[model samples]
Target chain A: MFQFKYPENFLRALGKPLVVFISRVGELSEFIARALYSCVTPPFYPRLLLKQIINIGFYSLPVVALTTLFAGMVIALQTHAGFSSYGAESAIATVVLISVTRELAPAFAGLMVAGRIGAAMAAEIGTMRVTEQIDALSTLSTDPYKYLVAPRLLAGVIVLPLLVVIGDIIGIFGGYLVAVYQLDFNPANYINATVNELQLIDITTGVIKAAVFGFVIALMGCYNGYKSKGGAQGVGEATTNAVVTSSILILILNYVITGLIFTE
Target chain B: MNQENNKIEVSELYKAFGRKRVLNGVNLSLKKGESLVVIGGSGTGKSVLIKCIQGLIEPDKGSIKIDGFETVGTPRKDCEKYYATMGMLFQGGALFDSLSVWENVAFGLIENQKMPKKQAKEKAIEVLRQVGLGADVADLSPSEISGGMQKRVGLARAIATKPEVIFFDEPTTGLDPIMADVINDLIISSVKKLGAAALTITHDMASARKIADKIAMLYQGKIIWQGTVEEMDKSDNPYVRQFISGSAKGPIKVEI
Candidate 1:
């Protein structure tokens, strides 16, 4: 009587990844829940919140402005090329404005901030975890979630929308420059077309997406960093994982939100 | 020290990380105003035991009671009372890099006790003075300080709150002999001044001998030997002898 050892091994192999994935999802959800809970609780640190806002918002302005400006300019040039073939060159301003406000600015700004702020949060918290500073905080009667994670999450939610709003303005300005001087479109016509086509719903959709993306970025960064172990290599891995996971989540959420908001 | 009133009581403690059991059935008790040092080689779970008491790492099974209040599995809000009564000096100082020395020392006071900043700073400075650090060093960041000074600052932070109990994790691990002695002296004086119960875990024989009123040796996830310093010197246990003598040839196998 032969036992089905091969089938048993196959089942075990197949179940391993499934088990790991389920557990990872469970842990991530728990982390996000705790972070959100801490945000509303007491023992709030205004100083830390202010510091993170400055770090994540004020310092990020230049980079966000540059990325969206270039993105807007490129979008105008490309739309001019594509639409000109269809004899729709006058649509360049409308396309650039809608794309910048409803898509490019928010998405680009989210990805950029994820790369910058997400990695920094991960590295800082991972170091704290490895060095036992996080534990030290607990032993000192301070909750690490209340002290560290809450501030970052709040700052991210508040500041990303502001950055995206600024990005939208700069991006539109960039498109204007390219449309007028480079493409030789009449300046007055371009401005009128942009203003006529822009809608409150378009700007609101981007702002809402930016807010969600910001929360995801900070959540991933803090979760990965807090759980990091094994010293320097662990911290490095957490930093990489923070940026990767946040960027992917931002893109995925952007599509999901867009579908919800714009679906006919 | 009155044995009837135990400051901390740990019983049947068990902790494991994925199949590697770090602590098994560890039982120890410290009386009020007593100093107990747990000595063991690296990888012996000394740090894990302290962390369990501090509620930093939850043990798989254990009962840790402080002043007769059970701490294991207590809600964080309820545990704050226990945390406020205890102080810990981490193995690597573990100072917040973002904060200055004074800010670090005053952290518990400012954050937990809700003390005003100016008063907290004055208390921090007073604690620094107790640790033989000057007022000038208070404003400097931890990274700017020497390792010895950092250790002293860590001690200052630990004692600044005037807690009833203190835990020192490798207080003199990374220091010169003189600096180690200085730390040992500071630890002794701070405990005496506060009349606090102290629990220190270290592999340094000299530090352990100097700081402990009672001594315990941990091996293979259990306390293999425990006695007073004088009793420790005269103990006939092979594990204790081999450990105290720093001999490689013994019942305790060197992993290498």
Candidate 2:
């Protein structure tokens, strides 16, 4: 074994990451369950949860809406140009409709929402941890998770789906506008075509996908924030992790969900 | 003494961070309405010890009896009932910036007690006044205040619910000596006024003598010396002498 020279130092460094990984897993698991538990638990902090719902969920709307709209337009243009050479231009409506609703809308919406609200949650709680308010809250007879993490996760899971569903609708409309007005498709026919082309399964699958992505974003955000240690640098790392992990998880999960749903 | 009625008991405690041990077989008692100051060098687990008792950092092995109810590994739900009796002034004032000073002070009362805002604000003003801040200052933001003022607000918030116990983490570390003494005097008087048990963590000896009825010097994860303030000057422990006098050349060498 090559453990003679650097043994102790290697063990110490290795222990931190292992503990960190385990701690993060515990935090995420607890938050997900507790958010569900607190729903039926008496003495619900409804006012506090409402405030968080507004802050983390509703406030992210304008950005998610705008980003989805623009993304939908770009996808439309890209599909139009590519399909033209293959003489498959007539199928552009179905292509844009499926891709935007099932994939782009949910994926980009999750990523954007994750980057915005996820970073803010991590930074806020991370700062609180470093500053010792989390400890202070404990001394004051409050559960920091119940008081802080629960509401945020509750709002994220409950609200992001609605936001993404709205985004899916808005994104499809964006494609329609580009298709009808600029791409020279008939306006009424474009609208009718989009509706006819999109099966209920496509729309339902996208909404379900958005819900899963929402869970991923909230889980990553709360986990990073709850386990945040050290000071400014640690908070920065948690915020960065919230964004990176949520985005990656959203992409990866999208593929899995798509395979399961579309294949069946 | 009637003050001893307010004491917390610790017994046969052992804690370690992996192979590097901290809190090796520690035991002590802090009396009611009495102030105990825990002083130690940097990295000596002074904060860790306090955190352990408060249930922030769980100890590997120990018994912490708060007013006689043992707190070792108590379920967090039950811990909330225990927490209702404690308050803390963090190393840096941890006032929530999103709220006004009064709101920060009223956080617990409103959230936990479900007290209405008007009643909480009225009570918050009373506590703020007790800490020497006027009612007019209660509306200002925590960031808008000076460091000393923030500490005062933090102190006010700690005593707001009138908890039976309070912990001060480095209350005087960042202040000028004059301000530090002011904080020390405020802490002493407020603890006396509330008749609350106080446990303050610091390496500041000057503040220790002024605020603590008992002094415990922690080093290498253990309370190496514990005595009444008067007895500390006569104690012959080399580590205690070196730590109290601020001498660089001693048994306690800086890692540098």
Candidate 3:
């Protein structure tokens, strides 16, 4: 009898989670729509925008720089080792240039920032929610969406591309340093190879990816925090969820965007 | 009895969290410049009632009227102007930790009223002084202050706009006896001074007696009894008597 019900039970268990996931997606889409609507409406807050830009962009530089730099160096070393075995070691510069601009730098910087800034945004907003500070804003006649969410969304869209551009340059410089100093490649030749391999498409793709990743990071952070309940435990869960969801979304979206952009 | 004289009029309010049924068919009203206190035990939906009035939480079914204007289902934009005339002090003070004490107080003036920063700061300082907080404490962060001081700052912030109506949620929940009395006094003086229609929700009977022109006891999502403080002393209702005397064994059962 139990064996006969096994498939039905399995389907039921799957159905519940599928329903939950779909509803969550719906809620998130509505949240994003409202945030975007607030973005386009009047009563913008430049001061808050500037503050968020500083917090999300300027403050994230060290981690982005360090992560991309190390990633680039490691990619250079690994490619060199692989290609040296086949006597194609000179291709190291080309590989480093393409990978840094097209994939590694943006993804690494996004993931790093997701961990740092996403968690912070969730924690801060969750605290505000539980403490009734968000309600206070409403009673004070300030729109919390316009004041909190819009500034963050706009700042993320504005500044992530800038951060990624800087990250790209720093990452390439890391590759250059390793090729010239550690790998015994001539500095001028390596530079020439890197310049020749770099493409407009490569740079543009990274910039676009960075922008989407930024939006995802900010969105997950704000959504989780704003919806958080209970208390300290709720905030803690929200922060963790923000970081995890944004990081996963960064990776998944990277692949999706890459596929879409590169498709014929 | 006069609808025109009522500052707030709520009728048949219903709110439920899932199947919990937090508030059921509630009705109440506050007259102009009158301080009405809602008393209830834990989990009794007093906060929900106050939040529903503030437009922070939309009730499932109800009519909430401010100055005879129906507010339920009104668009936030249509109601924006009304918020300018209203103020709230949250249970936990709810001061924005990111902002300094003065900025917290002056938030409504600078943001909603578009007053200049310097003028708002001066106003905040003056309001802070009124709350018995010194001007020196204005520049400090809310975290640097004690719980009592933070409550005072919250009160100052609530009254900074000189609102026509004010709501306080658990105004004296976390304070010592002396500090609670001080807050009770501040609340009384502030409401009197502003001549604002005030609604406060708290379980603290002492604070309620000190501040309320009318006291209503909330039980299981309904106002079971309402009367003046003097009348409350002589009420025959078992719930009212039990609550007033703070008796554990009574018609009101502790959930535990």
Candidate 4:
């Protein structure tokens, strides 16, 4: 095996990508640190911050609403089917309430906003980067991190929890409509069961998860966009990367946040 | 040559991306209120040189003294005071698509100097008119405007702050010759009106001839020659002659 053999390019190829990936992670960490520092610095842009809140929160409502609503209804139907096999249909209300508040609402909202808002942020900032608008911002004596990244991070961290709260209510309502109207459960009794089992921890944990997810989405979008180069193709790649990375991060973080907060 | 008389003095500048050096020992000085134009072939690091001075691209080695204060390797916050008195007109206009045209023009005034919105709007309109744009165009988004008009708006934004020094990056590249001339005239007038020292980088020979009071030719990361436009016409250096003459045959080789 040791007989005068040159190593193939296989290790070189694999090592190159590995090194690039590690460097990319390090760059992203530095970018996030700068963004967070800009967030706390003075000369805050209230106009830009308000605009992003409306963008990330208000504009994202219909999509998040529709996603969570359908999610709740689907879970309601599925739980009724499974529990009814044991004549335990009465447990459906508890299942719907706990699942919607503790998991489904926040996860769906995060994914929905990641797809809608994250991609848009990447495309917008990516275009600005290639077009020299970000450079233009700097020559005007405005810090690009403060002007572009901080408002977005602040808006995401502040607004996503509010969005998740809305999603939680609408999602529970969706489950309620299914249980009372279609499944022949008593409206008053189903409401009683859902409300009785709604622990404060479920809602609080979901909100906390929503904030973390929001930060991830904004960070991925801004970071990808900021580093974009070349032309329209580069911006297209950034948009795709923003959505894909943020969605994966949301799912992975969902498990971690759930395990950390819900465990004894 | 007096230090206090110069607005910007860049000495022994060197920059490289990986193994490919873009600038090597670039020595240039702009006296206050003087117009110096750098001309070079495309991809010859003309833009990179300007960016290095703007502090947008950090040069590997250089001393860039803006108003006699060293800027190279200085912390960004410390450089902000230097940048505040400077303005740049980007080649693409680089107008903020998010804001209306007037907002784009007034951005620096309102955001950096903290001017009141109403006052800034008035100032924006005034600057727009100075750039040969009508006040009606103020409310329109930059995307709605034509390229020539965007350049005007870019010029308007550049001068809006009454910056002491101005940098123009390819101010006339994408426009037709006639529109290019009009922009050249406007650039001359704007620089004159502001009494601002101007540094422009362009490959357009006609634009360089029209806008430059003094010209410098950059080739392969060095200023091969520098002199007045008349001196450029008489330059015996084959590189400068080949560039100004637009000849494919000479010491300069075309990759294509």
Candidate 5:
């Protein structure tokens, strides 16, 4: 009797991916632990930290502003269209303010930074890994985790909250521009509604989410870059993976944090 | 046996990447202030041997003693004492792009030894002069330098701390013949001046003859043959003959 080896083939096909997935998670956890350990340890590089803060926060402002502004504008347009049918168009300001402050600004800004700074970090570190610069640092008795990863991680954690705050203001202003000038809404009334509807908790939640997103973005970039192999192709793949993984992580964490903060 | 005479010794070194074994029971030793160059074809584990010695890559099983201290599997903090005495010149120079040429040379002094920047800068310029570079090149970024100049800068950085041991990884790989000779001469003079024990890995026969006081040929992850430079010229080992003659017809298969 000939029996089809369905379960056997299924297991064979699934085995490699399962192993890869498990190993990836293990590597990521170990990397994060080492990075965090380095963060609190001595031999800190204040100059590198300041450089990363400027690079990640100050240099990234224009992109974050542009992304959040367009996101806020689109939300206003959509909310106006939907609420006008029910004669609740006046509520557009409240909806835009709450959504922008609580979610879009942080999430969009995180994603933008992920695409820009995350990719750059991965490429730079990946190149350093391949060219033996990281090993050279080791031979020089310098720990790469302390010199390379910790500064970026600290900068990410510190700077993203500030960027998110700036992004929130720009986003709300974008909504105001559309609601008052384009949508024929009362400027004073819209501003009043926006201020009235926004709670301190709303902004805090987004700031907290921004901080976590920043850490995740920098971690993924540094981890993937440090672990890269092969050569130039490996660096390219790492950059892509850093951006994609950080973006997805930001979206996933945004939901998780939102659920935790807003749950009744 | 005088323990002070032997700067580094390796016994039964073994390292494998997954199924492919790169280093299999490799053994070697270097005397104080001696220059030993390992010559092999591409993919013959020459780089791996150097990396193992430097503790950049850990061996699967081995005993690596540097000045009588065991380094294999030693904790990184414990390994620092050995690393502090060592310097490496990477294949591609591997200078940090962010820092200028002089800063690259002074990195260890400033970052590790905590030397003042002004003093480190002076020392950097002094070392640069030793490597045949002028102070004018000090402020330029590494990207601004030529390949040969970059290699010289790398040499400057490697010798900046006056380390007791220096590693050269294919130092002459990407240079013109004249440039390669220039680097080889610089390496010889630098090692002689520093009185540093050196371990160099290369496939360039000309470089090996020029810089090596002793030569060891690595094949199949082992030192198949070793001798002084003159003895290397007259070696009868078929592997050595095949490699030195650059012949396609030999015991060493092309693997293709």
Candidate 6:
């Protein structure tokens, strides 16, 4: 199958760089999915890995929550100001919740968390790698994938859903605050409109998107770190790649997932 | 001129980075419980040779037989089992920053062997004590320790599994002479106590003399000379003599 695209001998002769790059991407995705699979299975490292999860996951609540809140408020004010000039100000609450719940919550939370934490994961693992601790781990008979890559991936999938839920709430509340207080919309009416308009699917879709984004963030981090070669320069390159790839992936995937979820 | 007995046997090994050969037809063997140091100028692939034996870097062609198990291109699964009986002290002490000292030492036992944490911790401390470190250092992060202390901790971690073979990559490069000797002494005693074969790579002749029963000199990707400590002094190889004497006025050209 591989030979159809390139000459068989030519591909085989390409060597470690070729294997490292292609397998790097595949192994990263597999590493993440494997972690998720392992998390759900037995012999769990709950206490140990959870401490890592809290580090990777819960500690970033302040940032995710804060960003969502302001984002929601800004979104509300913008939606209201534009509509009110057109004498359709009443559509503000509907627009705010739809945008916050369906669009902003998962996208913003995943991007924010990825920016803040993905670099740390890549740099931490990348440094371990460059310093040969990963080799040390192997010499000690520990699988670096099972121990290091698994924990990061598992936490990303598990924790981002919760973060997305929080982001959704904070984002809606931010929109509510702006709509009621700043936009001069009736508080009860705005609340009623938001409540009526938000279906179960809206929240579910956004949370699902957040989970995928979380997985991608972690995948990028681990891939960059795992594939990182050289010394300080390589580690720096990996850190940059982790953050940039996670951000770009979050945006691209958000559209793909949203289209699938929301299309009639 | 090996004495016909071999502990770590490497034959016809070859490795390359892109088109540049790092190890070219390298062949070496050391006897059981013997300390062999490979000395060479920087980037002469001294480290690469040790890595091949340790299975850190797979050789493109050759055989590395540790207790008769062929290591060249050994599958990663079998590689783990091969690694369980081996230890390494990375040039920079490579301790995991996220793990506390005790956890780092206990990493193998807990993760690979599935030993209980309590037993692993106890074993980790015991090994730490063997390296002249107190058990009190266990809870601290690796970052909290001084370079010498960190080196000791790395030594502790290396010997924790009581491995059958150990590789020390520039084991004393960054330490002061006194600390270097301290590490050298610890390496000797611990290897003796564990009855493990030890291979070290370094430019420090003092360290090599203190730790090695035999030494080899690698130059331009080949083993130019190897001998007992007594023979090392009388070695006719220009590279080995220049290396052991630390002479700048020799056939060696410094890359400056």
Q: Which number leads on DockQ?
A: 4
Query: After superposing candidate 4, which stretches have Cα over 4 Å from the reference?
Result: A1-14
lDDT of 5 by residue, B1-256 (tens): 6767899998899999989999989989999999999999999899998898888898999899999899998887887888799999999999999899999999999999999999999999999999999999999999998999999999999999889999999999999999999999999999999999999999999999998989999999998898998897788899999999999998999887
Order the candidate numbers by DockQ, best to worst: 4, 1, 3, 5, 2, 6
How far out, in Å, is residue A58 in model 1? Answer: 0.5
Candidate 2 wrongly placed segments (more than 4 Å) = A1-43, A85-88, B1-6
Q: For candidate 2, please provide the TM-score of chain A on its own.
A: 0.87
Considering only chain B, report the TM-score of model 6.
0.95
Candidate 2: residue A190 Cα off by (Å): 0.8
> How many clashes in each structure?
0, 4, 0, 0, 0, 0
lDDT of 3 by residue, B220-255 (tens): 999999999999999999999999899998999999
Off by over 4 Å in 3: A1-19
lDDT of 2 by residue, B1-256 (tens): 3433645777767787778787877776778777898998888787777788788888888788877778898876776677678889988898887789999888888878889999999999998888889999889999999999999999998998888888899999899999999999899989999999999989888999999889998777677788888899998999988888899989997988
lDDT of 3 by residue, A1-264 (tens): 234467777666677788778888899889988999999997999999999999989999999899889888998999998999899988998898888988998899899888988999999999999999999999999889999999998888888899999989998889888988999999999998888887899999999999999999999999999999999999999999999999999999999999999998
Model 4's C-alpha root-mean-square deviation from the true structure amounts to 2.3
Task: Output the better candidate (2/5) by lDDT.
Answer: 5
Lowest lDDT sum, 10 consecutive residues, model 4 chain B, at B216-225
Quickly count the clashes in candidate 5. Answer: 0
Question: Ten consecutive residues with minimal summed lDDT in candidate 6 chain A?
Answer: A1-10
Between candidates 4 and 6, the one scoring higher on lDDT is 4
Listing every candidate in turn, what is its Cα RMSD in Å to the true structure after a full C-alpha superposition?
Answer: 1.9, 3.4, 2.4, 2.3, 2.2, 4.1
For model 3, report the TM-score of its A chain.
Answer: 0.93
Chain B TM, cand. 4: 0.98
* Candidate 2 chain A weakest ten by summed lDDT: A1-10
**Residue B241 lDDT, candidate 1, scale 0-100:** 95
What lDDT does candidate 4 reach at residue A51? 97
TM per prediction: 0.97, 0.92, 0.96, 0.96, 0.96, 0.90
